[model samples]
Target: MDALWEGFQEAVRLIVRGDAGLREVAWRTIVVSGSATLLAMAAGVPTGYGLARGRFPGRTLVLSAVNTGMGMPPVVVGLIVWLFLVRSGPLGDLELIYTKRAMVVAQFLIAVPLVIGFTAAAVQALPAELPDLLAALGAGRLRTLWLLAREAQLGILAAVMAGFGGVISEVGASMTVGGNIQGDTRVLTTAIVTETSRGENANAMALGIVLLVMAFAVNLLLTAVQQRRRR
Candidate 1:
């Protein structure tokens, strides 16, 4: 208990002092995770809506694939991204490996299936009559989708929060794709690992605390948003 108290004090001191290294890691973590989450939402939300409303051939296969992807190992995601971005690989000419952009790409891929699967399930769970009612009103397909989305807004928000939660805490893909370079790609998770490995327990503990607090805050905010939507 004393150790924990001391760690908290140390973390507060660091934060109060504006610890340069910690701030840098926090900034990088937010940038990478935020960008990835946005990209995932942009792609996943529409795909999920389409899946919920349409019954084309191969739709089941696609949804199944998305569900499968949600369970994929982070290490595998890292390795695949690394391969594609590494020299001599198909996309090697882009030279995206071992960079912040690469980390964003990796996290984006990791979050996509999560958002899609969750959002699709959410949309499908709504009453079938909702879509039918929209159809009866002579609403176009696009407007119908929009109305359906509004009706299922809470679930879509939850899906986005869930995706953000996944990518925000991940270290495997971030480290592998970003190289965890100091003053560059290092994020809170990667920095914690690096500091811990080097016996900087105080710093590592501080970062861990910050990561937990930030994640908690994000979830709380998301919950509030969902509650507002429900009302």
Candidate 2:
């Protein structure tokens, strides 16, 4: 306990002093995680809505696949992404291997299902009268879905927060797809892992602190927003 406290204090001091390497890692984390979250929101929001409202023969199977993906191991995802981006791989021609874009793609994959599944849950939670109400008002399918989304805005926001939380802390896929290269793809989570393994305990602890603070801030903001929406 004493050692942990001392480590925490040291880490806070390093962060306060604006340690350059830690700052770089923090910035990269934000850039990669934010980009992935935004992309997931853009794509997942509508896709989830469609899944919730649209009927098809294989809809249940598709939903089941998404739910299963939500449990997929980070290392497995990293392996698949690494294979696809490796030289001689099908997508290797794009030269996206070991790039920030590759990390973004991996995190996007991680975030999408959370967004979709949670959004679907939110839509499903709506009153059954919702659809009938919209129909009585002559609302089309698109508009009705918009209404449903609005009613459950808080839930959807929660999904976004949850997804961001996952991606920001993810290391395996980011490290694999990003190569954890200094001054390029290095992010806070991967940096923590690297620094710790290299016996840079202070740096690892500092990066860990930053990651924790980011996670807390994200969840706090999500809670605040949801509460505000409720009122």
Candidate 3:
């Protein structure tokens, strides 16, 4: 109880004072997670649309794999990324291990499956005759995709929320691949973990508060957009 209250106070102080390190961690959290979310959306949205519409062979197997990936452990994702990027690994010649780039990659892998799953579900929910109607109305592939996407913006925004939320809040993969180096790869989630590891419970909680606020703020913006679209 006392610890939580102390953490609340510390959180207020950190925010009011605009602590440099805290700000840095917060900003990096946004950059890395935001980048990952955007990349996931870019890659996953189209693929999901295809899955929902296409009739190619092995599609069921692919969707099943994506569904499995949606629930895969973040730490395992981190370990896989680490293995691929680590020195002496196949792609290690690029030397991206233990960097912000690596963190972004890990988070992207963590978020993409969720994006795909959500997008597929959302796209599949639309009227089955809608595609044929659009095609009959002379909408080409890209144009049809755009129109369908606008119609399904709500789910896409939901995917945005889920993707950003997933990456921003995940500590395991970020710490594992990012190495949590101060001023470089350290993000809010990893910072909280660092504080807790050293027994700084109050600071950990304070950082958690900051993380929640950040996530809430981003979600609020997306929700506002979603609701406006709904109206």
Candidate 2 yields a Cα-based lDDT of 0.86
**Which consecutive 10 residues in model 2 have the weakest lDDT in total?**
1-10
State the lDDT of candidate 3 residue by residue for 1-231, as single tens digits. Answer: 988999999999999999998999999999999999999999999988889889999999999999999888899999999999999888899899999999999999999999998999999999999989999999998898999999989998998898898899998999899999998999999999899999999999999999999999999999999999999
How well does candidate 2 match the true structure in TM-score terms? Answer: 0.94
| Candidate 2 ranges with C-alpha deviation above 4 Å | 140-142
TM-score of each: 0.95, 0.94, 0.98
Candidate 1 lDDT over residue span 1-231, tens digit each: 654676687789888999888788888888999999999999999999889878999999999999999988877899999999998889999999888999999999999999998889989999989888888999988898888888888889988998999999999999888899999899999998998899877778888888888888888998998998898
List pairs with backbone clashes in candidate 1: none
Question: 2 or 3, which is superior by TM-score?
Answer: 3
Taking the tens digit of each residue's C-alpha lDDT, what string does model 2 give over 1-231? Answer: 554566688788877898887777788888999999999999888888788877999999999998987777777788898899888888999899899999999999999998998888788788878889998999998898788888989889988997898799889999888998989999988888998899877667767877999889878988998888889
Single out the weakest 10-residue window by summed lDDT for candidate 1. 1-10
Task: Give each model's whole-structure lDDT.
Answer: 0.89, 0.86, 0.93
Ranking by TM-score: 3, 1, 2
The superposed Cα distance between candidate 1 and the true structure at residue 145, in angstroms, equals 1.8
RMSD of each: 1.4, 1.5, 0.8
Model 3 is weakest, by summed lDDT over 10 consecutive residues, at 156-165
